[model samples]
Target: MSTTTIDRYRFETGIYRPPSEGGSASLLLRYTRNCPWNHCTFCSMYKTEKFQLRPVADIKSDIDAMAAVVDDLKAISMDIGQNGTITRDAAVSLIGKVPALNYHEGFAMLFHWLLSGARNAFLQDANSLIMKTGDLVDALHYLRSTFPSINRVTTYARSRTLVQKSPEELTAIRKAGLDRLHLGLETGDNELLKKIKKGVTAKGHIKGGKKAMVAGFQVSEYWMPGLGGREMTGVHAAHTARVLNEINPDYIRSRPFRTIPGTPLHAQVNRGEVQMLRPHEQLLELKNMIGALDVTSRVCFDHAMNNWRHPRSGLLFTHDYEGYKFPEEKQKVLELIEAGLNAGNPVSGAG
Candidate 1:
């Protein structure tokens, strides 16, 4: 039988690839069509598209489609192989065992296992926080009901949007099974925030971040080094570290700033209004920023976008011994890049 097929995954166009912090996987649902404040100079999430929200019904349909397939699996018992590794021939042979078999369910069961680690699910498409809290809660409830085995649920949120929401609203959201909130804090320097058109003041980030913490939600605040350029690197590092100290979120993530074509920051570069720091300079800035970190937040260098891709590459990541951690091992990465640049290699920043 020939059945129509629909692709289930979707995402925005950007130079970004998922960072490996803690090895968490990403899945895209695309609730927010584009960044609400799309003027971030160094960003390319929705550079060519107008910002908007995907309709709730459309989102519901996507979930329903997946659920429908899962429902089919509940109707019959497929054969179980050793360690649950059902080979294709075995799966087909098992499907033949059922009186009335479902191809959709068989395919979906394999996909479900692949997506959720056969354990938890990850939803994505930039900022799902743009969804109304009630709508999001309903969706979360639906997913939990459907999967029943999803251990943790998570999503991305903007500081400004989070700040605009009432604490009560956020608490209710927390109760709805949102285990983690990823906030792209880029840089907490007020000047850097303004320049990026982040639309949230440094204070706003702290306010919203604190609210999430108050609601018992784990918060990951992500930032980018090299965003301050040459002129304000010190101020940017110092201020960002200071802000993180105040927010003291569960995770402080670093994304090394890189140039992407068609972004506003690229234009700034052309006009000489922005300066992309050298690899060594960026490491110095990171060092300053890390040195200034008086707070006890766990620093993460997990993402592929980070200058330091190795989680335990050097002193920064292994500083639990002496109780001194800075850039955790980013200087080692910086030194490698600096050598490349000196040797006349293109030396683009790590992703």
Candidate 2:
């Protein structure tokens, strides 16, 4: 391959995405640079970085560069006995030829994504909807056209941004091929919401989530279980359940509160101001939330933070991405929580 062709394989990627995207499973397509809302007390992600929206032209160029990587990989495959199949030998051969790929940030991610059937992708950094509607739509169109193998394109979004966007603009972006939104609804209690500086209220969470649903985006709402601690746990669970019931999103994920070291919440925890929940207490809180919940959404304890012991299995909850389907599996989930509560305190708290 020519030097120009080798250079064509360069692209930009950011550091974070949802766990369900799988390690090296989805291409890290950067639409924005960092977290636009970096004020969350509990968050340490993108704290030292500033947020920036890349130009649509630059974004499209990144897409083209990514496509060049795939094309070259396929070419290498064709040259080998694999006949265009993306294989280990082809990737090894490409790396051998272009040794610079060893130092490329997005190289391993892109190659593994192709190996995984290239069916899914996650837009990187924090929020993508903060971009101008026309620009977002243009980029989405270019992306959909460029990688037709990618059916699911998900992104992290602030609830406030969704509320600020016009209905028509959201519909336009949705129609342009953006599929799902992962919203961080840490807690629905007004006090905790304000304490975290989440930048959106319980009322606002419902409105933004409903708007996204109306605009044809599959919504995945995440809530932190012990965010309020013992003082506010009851209200937190009840109100969070109420909000989720109102939104009835496609997914309701549990991200148990883990105080990150450089974060404001960690300082609070150290100061004895914000107490973390014990394992059993966390389970009881989950029961309260699950009991109050009335939605058709999938309730997931997909993160390691949901650490508690089960009598039979090692973990209290299954770390399945598509968690227990609500309404049908609600009873089963409650029973599991009871089991965890009854089972001894040999378990550990992730937070």
Give the winner by lDDT.
Answer: 2
Model 2: runs farther than 4 Å from truth? 2-6
Q: Tell me the RMSD of model 1 versus the true structure.
A: 6.2
Off by over 4 Å in 1: 5-27, 71-116, 308-351
Query: In candidate 1, residue 26 scores what lDDT?
Result: 33
Give the TM-score (vs. native) of candidate 2: 0.97
lDDT of 2 by residue, 168-286 (tens): 99999999999999999988888899999998999999999999999999999999988988888999999999999999999999998878898999999999998888887888898
For candidate 1, lDDT tens digit of each residue in 240-338? 988898888877777778777888877888798987787657766877887677665667666544433232233223222122233454455345434
TM-score of each: 0.76, 0.97
Consecutive 10-residue window with the lowest summed lDDT within model 1: 8-17
Worst-scoring 10-residue span by lDDT in model 2: 1-10
Q: After TM-score superposition, what is the CA distance of residue 325 in candidate 1 from its true location, in Å?
A: 9.0
